[model samples]
Target: MSLASHLDELSRKHSDIERQINAAMLHPSIDALEIANLKRRKLALKDEIEKLKSQPTSH
Candidate 1:
């Protein structure tokens, strides 16, 4: 897949993760460890997206 498409997919995933985190937070029986893991994964994805965006494109 092209870089643009890949970026789009990653962006969608990031948004999904954000929604998941929010939903998890609103739950009455929220698991701390689970939320931490989700947050870690989200941060990793964000870092990856930023790194990809910073790289120079070959066109």
Candidate 2:
């Protein structure tokens, strides 16, 4: 897959994770560990997105 497509997929996943985190927060009985795990995954995705953005794209 091309870099652009890969970046788009990552962005979509990051957005999905954000939605999941929000939904989890709204739950009456939130699991702390679950939220922490989601947050960690979100951070990792963010780092990857940033790294990809920083790389020079080939024509």
Candidate 3:
């Protein structure tokens, strides 16, 4: 796949993960550990997206 395609896929996945984390956080029965893990995963995805955005596009 091309770089743009890869970035699009990553962005979609990041959005899905963000939604999941938000849902989990809103659940009253969610365990603290689970919430923490979800948050960590969200942060990692955000970092990856930022790294991809910072990369120079190939002509």
Candidate 4:
């Protein structure tokens, strides 16, 4: 896949993760440990998306 496509996929995945985190935060029954884990994963995705954005484009 091309760099642009790869970046786009990453962005979409990041958005999905963010949505999951939001849901977890709003769910009263969510376990503390599970919420923490989800938050960590979301932050990691955000960092990766930032890295992808920072890279120079091939085109």
Estimate the overall C-alpha local distance difference test score of candidate 2.
0.93
Which whole-number lDDT from 0 to 100 does residue 13 have in model 2? Answer: 95
TM-score of each: 0.93, 0.90, 0.78, 0.74
Give the range where candidate 3 is weakest over 10 consecutive residues by summed lDDT: 37-46
What is the TM-score ranking, best to worst? 1, 2, 3, 4
Cα lDDT tens digits, model 4, 1-59, are: 87778878877887887788788889899888987887788788778878878988766
RMSD (CA, Å), each prediction:
0.8, 1.1, 1.4, 1.8
Residue 21, model 4, lDDT: 74
Model 1, TM vs. native? 0.93
Q: Which candidate is the best by lDDT?
A: 2
| Alpha-carbon lDDT, every model | 0.92, 0.93, 0.82, 0.80
- lDDT measured at residue 57 in model 4 versus the true structure, 0 to 100: 71
Worst 10 residues of 1 by lDDT: 28-37
lDDT tens readout by residue for model 1, 1-59: 98889999988999999999999999969998999999998999899999999999886
- Highest TM-score: which candidate? 1
Judge candidate 4 against the unseen true structure and give its global Cα lDDT, from 0 to 1: 0.80
The residue pairs in collision within model 1 are none
